[model samples]
Target: MAYVISDDCIACGTCIDECPVGAISEGDKYSINPDMCTECGTCADVCPSEAIHQG
Candidate 1:
């Protein structure tokens, strides 16, 4: 499954740098492109708000 960005996202842009596949997008709350996501879990690891999780 792909990792999802939840409502808890702080829009800190931390996960963007950690996404190897560039699946994350900028917004009030960041989004993850499931199609491009590699489920690497790097984004989740770095999320300050603990927003990223497996979908």
Candidate 2:
């Protein structure tokens, strides 16, 4: 399953750099494109707010 970034995200860029598949993108809140995400959980690990969760 791909990870999803919730509203709780603080707009921190940690997930962007941690994403091995480069699926995370910057926006009002960072988002993980399911089509591109590899479900490696790298983004969740780096998220300070624990905003990224299983989708």
Candidate 3:
């Protein structure tokens, strides 16, 4: 499954650079495009708020 950004996201833009597939997008809470996400977990590793997780 792809990783999902939870409401806990702080929109810090940290996860964007960590996504190797560029699946992350900036927004009020940031979002991960499941179609593009590779489920690499890089974003989750870098998320300061621990908002990204397996979905």
Alpha carbon lDDT of each predicted model: 0.93, 0.89, 0.90
lDDT for position 52 in model 2: 91
Q: What would the TM-score be for candidate 2 when compared with the true structure?
A: 0.94
Stretches of candidate 2 off by over 4 Å are none
Residue 25, model 3, lDDT: 89
What's the lDDT of the predicted structure labeled candidate 1? 0.93
lDDT of 1 by residue, 8-40 (tens): 999999999988889999999999999999998
Best by TM-score: 1
Which stretches in model 3 have alpha-carbon errors above 4 Å? none
Tell me the deviation in Å of residue 38 in model 1: 0.4
Per-residue alpha-carbon lDDT of candidate 2 for residues 1-55, written as tens digits (9 for 90 to 100): 8899999999979888888878988998988889999888888888899999999
Cα miss at 30, model 1 (Å)? 0.3
Lowest lDDT block of 10, candidate 2? 12-21
User: Candidate 2: RMSD over Cα atoms?
Assistant: 0.6
